[model samples]
Target chain A: MNFPPPITRLIQHFRGLPGVGPRTATRFVFALLNKSEDELRAFGHTLVDFKHSIRTCKECFNISLQDPCEICSNQKRERTLLCIVARPQDIQAIEETREYNGLYHVLGGVLNPIDGVTPEQLRIKELLTRLEGEQKFQEIILALNLDIEGEATALYLAKLLKSRVPKVTRLARGLPQGADLEYADEVTLINALKGRRDI
Target chain B: MNFPPPITRLIQHFRGLPGVGPRTATRFVFALLNKSEDELRAFGHTLVDFKHSIRTCKECFNISLQDPCEICSNQKRERTLLCIVARPQDIQAIEETREYNGLYHVLGGVLNPIDGVTPEQLRIKELLTRLEGEQKFQEIILALNLDIEGEATALYLAKLLKSRVPKVTRLARGLPQGADLEYADEVTLINALKGRRDI
Candidate 1:
């Protein structure tokens, strides 16, 4: 189909985003075209600033606006209690509970060798370094997904943290299997938090 | 949930897109953040150019890189055969069939009174002007969707075009009701084309 060059290019660009196929990409382009001139320019400016404005925390390896992130920098946080999760968004899910007042380690993703995601590819080194640093974390919690990849990652990290940290624990079997921590309700996460047991 | 400020802002921006909700927007933002820096920058550049690089055709009101749009400007197109569609993407769906060699007029959207969309709000005036112009369109095809709004708009246009053009027809009622032309299969459109009846 001979869409005008610029419109076709715009659709292709939209398709590059995750989960957006050809039809969705075309829909996005049309939606953008229908927007007001000011709104379009603002959206473009936001896109330009999106990558530039975000920073990875030096300690937690989470996406944020600052080097250490607000969660890592907050004085009230229980620095001795560290919770490790797969992705940055998982931290939001955990934080919403207000049940655990601990620091975090964002792995960015889990260990999935089939998908070419290895331990080294994740922020595992950073997690280890943070544990080794001045912050004497007494408890390290593995708050990962209940899937095969998440299980493998948990086992690998648990083995590593057990020798160094005073106590190493997993989020317990309360969360339904195959569920993402990012999408889990606060009650479910809270239950998992309360029932957490040492690995 | 308290996501990092910049990350949250990016999620909100993505949620503004059609068909995207809170969860999908968050997922899109995370996926984008996972992309390589160069790819992210290139995507930003494309977004900036998206609105700036495109123009509306003076004659058809369709989005294009040029003033009159490629379809309206092409001399080889059947100047007598004009296809009226709801949006620019509809034109792509129709063009995919390679069945219609006519020009198009994009109404931007169909009239929905409850949505405050009146005739004056759409490109109806431009469509009427085209009918009154020197270019004698022998057949004006109302290729709108099969929805209530689409049906209403097509009927309105058909009534108006019947008096001006030698022939005014609509795509056959072969399409399923409430289906968007943008998502209709090429085969469906082709069948509708073959069975078109006079309005």
Candidate 2:
């Protein structure tokens, strides 16, 4: 009766999301209230579409509208070279660079025991399958975050891939430690890509 | 090809929102990617329902699913006292106090000419109408923000209401300047309500 009850429930749902506290959640709910019915419906549809219309690329575990994804289907990209990233957004960051024309492998997560995320829990098995298959990758570039988890994941991947692949590299350390690939400036990404060294 | 071109559009849309920048937007998009198809659809449906189900109260301009709103319809509420707020969320803050059982008036927005919002743009006319009928308000509390704009709006309303209503009181100013009522802690709000003095 006070807030129509449903609005309160919606605010609570918003507050459940990461980084959204009670105040921010309340603001967001009211902001939605300010929107016209059409706009609100559109927002809801977008959220639904984003969830339903999008799928993970079966090949790279990257987000897409299809199974294999456009990148996986494209013949122009170098299948011999694969870039390893922690999340789908990291792949987007690298794609924006327009430097690498290679394929990608999304790990889905980093190796963090504290969070109970292990390499086995990630898409590492898929990467291994791709590497050991008839289509062999000549190089694997680790483009994960520069944080502790990223470093640990990269190191674990490097150790795993070094014995299998011809070459294994990580994004250069010129990138500030603890920086996310998604947040790194294009210039920094380009620099890191160009200056990448053997890891 | 990498992340589905439409994903970029969604991320850009999120970044355009207030307080959401590129990095946070990417985080949100990736979090979306982690959700299952059903969850995504539910999120979308919630958004759409949020838009479709909610309506502004006709009399007080408060966000609700009803016309007069539950608060306005409640028989137990004090009809002689009206609490004026800048937005719908402000009403929530006042309700949490349990001290006030009066009906509410949502101004919709403060007077900000720079953004091209005039007195006519808000619910001022409806407020005046509410006070004009045989059901008159004994005290009209201006519980708006304490910022320059809020102060300006309150002053404008006080002057206008003085000739119409018997009493036009404002929420006390011990509340930190520029602080939003929605963000103020319960103790501060309660104290402000307790220490309220006549303007």
Candidate 3:
């Protein structure tokens, strides 16, 4: 059965979202139908105003309401230590730990050759320019994921920045908190043993 | 970290959806951030226009662009055979089967006292009124789910409708088309055996 044009259009928009299929999209449309008119209008206004209200931070390339973003503009953060990440959401994840007090640079994505993501597509040039500018960062931390693409990107950046910067480092890989040794993968076990510290 | 007001509001809207949590809602908001301005505006317009474009069918209580709905207005459908379902989506499901060419009556929901879903909340009155009207239905099929609420609803309706309608029936209870005898539950196996046909 053919849904109404408005419902079909909304379903199509929802279907464009990540991991959402036709059935889920249809369910979303029906759920929306149950909402009050004012709620629907508010949701619509939010979508329309989303892009206008948010802008890419010029200093760090993180999406924010301000040009420099909260972290970049803040005065108390450790300016000499820069943490490089693949996405803005990663910054939030790190912030939740309350361990890192450094600034952040969002690279947008990793070096994914299969999907055609390269150095030119990333903010590598911008990062180099930032490093070369007046700000003298003591260390550059490649806080990327442990996946293949993240590893390749970290390696490429570390090689390019080794001579330019005082120090370049990647996040330590080890068995995660509460992980069982029996179920721990070989690579993680090896990394955990290699990086083990005396208690 | 606190997101921008617009981003947070949009995330809240996505969080209101069924089965979506804070993380998924945040993911949805970020995904929408990547969409083009024009696409975002189109989606916004669709949401705003959703309620205005759709109306509940007065005759069958189905949500549609038309008041009577396409099914109620269609002349080719079998008017004398009516199928009663709990929701409008069930109508679409039955239509996809291509087996039932009869008219439909959407009950809005079944009788669930725990959730405060009483007979007054459902379209039971509307159904009775329609049955008492000039339309002489040969049979009224209670096509509800086999769950507790559905069973209670069907039993209640059967008792109420047995004297009102010429004939009242229900969908056959048996093993599904691809169901295995070994894996089938005891209740389903008993029903399948009891309802066995000559074939």
Candidate 4:
């Protein structure tokens, strides 16, 4: 037999989430069902509030509470060093390292022709406009993923921004921190060897 | 840096779900953020409506749209056969099999003294009351899991239900369909050997 209509509806909504299949969605629904009416209502309100409050930063295309985002609006951040990323969440990952003190530009997603993710679909035009405007960055860092799509996007952006920016660099590819050299893939080993630095 | 306040709140809520870690929770929140405002609002409304409309079945203790539940109220189901399970979700699993036509009794949880899950906390009292009342069942099946706690509960319930009902039966333990005998655990293999039947 099928679940109740309300349960099924909630499950369907949860199934839309990334990596969440029917079973996981069902578990989430049941877990929510166990909560008190007040707690459930609060969760619902939180969801609505999240949607209502969240806005994409017009400058960087990053999702935030404000239009320009806290990073783009901050005066102390290094305007000369611009880091380009694939998505808003990637900015969080870079920020967590606390190593870089620079502005960011979110590309929305990497260029994947098969998936219909073209330059127009992403924020490439916006990035070009921002770079062409008053801001003059000394270096533009393409901090996208190490996948084929990310590489293609990075190459495309690097070529496009070479004339506008002084230097275009990508994040170094090497054996990740705490990763065993024995388990390192052939390409990672080759990259690590090719990009070796003197201590 | 951490996510925005609303995103963090929703992430916290998602993290409270079974098997969902902080990363998975963050992914879920971001996925929700990607949805349109109206769709997100509808999802929020669905959550509230789910909690409001859904109620525990007074007869079987299963979570359902109505008090008695569709199963408890159905006339075609076999009232003479009652199946006892630990959680409400177990009823859905058994119903999916379509092998049994009996009514159900949800015990909420098995008796786990270490975790403070005493008989008092379970629906043991309700089961006893039902058995003692006018609903006479020819066979009471204990369809709990095959783990230590389930075994303990099944044994306890079988003994208690023996005097009340004409017969008290537990689900047959054997090698599961398509399960490799070579990789079978010792306990399961022993059970399979002991419970061997004629073809």
Give the per-residue lDDT digits (tens) of candidate 2, residues B1-199.
3455566666765664568887887777777766677776766677667656677778888777888788988889999999999888888888987999999999889999999999999998988888888888899999988778998999999999998888989876558779899999987788789888889
Q: Could you give candidate 1's per-residue lDDT for residues A143-180 as a string of tens digits?
A: 99978999899999988889999999987666887989
Off by over 4 Å in 1: A174-199, B175-199
Stretches of candidate 2 off by over 4 Å are A51-55, A175-199, B5-17, B51-55, B175-199
Clashes of each: 0, 2, 0, 0
Report the interface RMSD that candidate 1 achieves against the true structure, in angstroms. Answer: 2.1
DockQ: the better of candidates 3 and 4: 3
Q: Rate the local accuracy (lDDT) of all candidates.
A: 0.84, 0.81, 0.92, 0.90
Question: Could you list the iRMS of every candidate?
Answer: 2.1, 2.9, 1.0, 1.3
Residue A42 lDDT in model 4? 84
Better of 2 and 4 by lDDT: 4
TM-score of candidate 1 against the unseen true structure: 0.82
User: Which of the numbered candidates is closest to the native, going by highest DockQ?
Assistant: 3
Candidate 3 scores an iRMS of 1.0
The alpha-carbon lDDT assigned to residue B181 of candidate 4 equals: 90
TM-score of 2: 0.81
DockQ score of the complex predicted as candidate 4: 0.74
Kindly list the per-residue Cα lDDT of model 4 for residues B1-199, writing each as its tens digit: 5678989999988888999999899888888877888888889899988877778998989888888999999999999999999988899999999998989999999989999998999999999899888888999999999889999999898888888899988888878899999998999999899999999
Worst 10 residues of 2 chain B by lDDT: B1-10
Model 2 interface RMSD over true interface Cα atoms = 2.9
lDDT of 1 by residue, B59-174 (tens): 88777788988888889899899999998878888988899998999998999999999999899889888888898899989999888999999999888778889999987656
Identify the CAPRI category of the predicted complex in candidate 4: medium
In model 3, where do residues sit more than 4 Å from their true spots? A180-186, B174-190
